[model samples]
Target: MAMGMASSGRRRGNRTRRAAMAEINVTPLVDVMLVLLIIFMVTVTLPAVGVPIELPESRANPVEELPDQVNISVDNAGRIYLENDPVAPGGFADALATIRRNDGEQPVIVLRGDTGLDYGRVMAVMGELNRAGFKSISLVTDGSDTAP
Candidate 1:
């Protein structure tokens, strides 16, 4: 009887069909994401522009610098410098348009106006920035505490 049952079990096992595995594995995807994260972290660059200015002392907190923010500086003489290069009033539109084209999004600007610069000059520069499609503006000032 045992031999007869063993022969029947073999026949049933050979005749049965199993379904194929269809689930996706995510280990590779997670590995790629981690690599990309590390790459971005290691490639971070510091913001440095040698354009000198006497910044006004302020009690307000400083704004965090982002990787993509455009830097514009105004001198006491009311001359405008874009990314450390002098920008002419006649070519202002073209210079801003080029930046806008490269960024391809709503732009943000960090303006470092000299402490001795005229208020009207700063305002005029701000207005031009607004008209050139960079609506977000930030003034860079030195954080200070009154000390004897």
Candidate 2:
């Protein structure tokens, strides 16, 4: 009876060891899932939201070398200016055509509309750019504060 009791105790010890090890073994699985999640998050780039206006304040970090930028400004009155030169409403297409003729590579069109202008007006300009086949377009803003 003493020997039988000892053997049963040894079997219980082995079962306990196996039960402790069978805890789903989730540590390695969790590590792998976390790594894949990080990889996907890093690879994805979120689209820019809103009207691309009302840019927040930031310290100036001017690039030493940058490509030539074509400036397009829209005033509060909705007048469009192409690089300091006033462009008539009917002349926008012509101006864009000229730019394309000058440079086959699409010039980076920087749209700078007045803050007081309607949001729809800004979107209209973006639509025109898309129609004109301008692939690279950006919105420009002034970093100055008028509160003073």
Estimate every model's Cα lDDT from 0 to 1. Answer: 0.79, 0.67
Candidate 1: residue pairs that collide: none
Cand. 2 Cα-lDDT: 0.67
lDDT (10s digit) by residue, model 1, range 27-102:
9999999999999988885445668888888887877787787889988888788898999877776777778434
Candidate 2 segments whose C-alpha is farther than 4 A from its true place: 1-67, 101-103, 144-148
Give per-model TM-scores: 0.62, 0.51
The C-alpha stretches of model 1 lying farther than 4 A from their native spots are: 1-47, 101-103
Worst ten-residue run, lDDT, model 2? Answer: 47-56
In candidate 2, the residue pairs with backbone N, CA or C atoms under 3 Å apart (3 or more residues apart, or in different chains) clash, namely: none
User: Which 10-residue window in model 1 sums to the lowest lDDT?
Assistant: 5-14
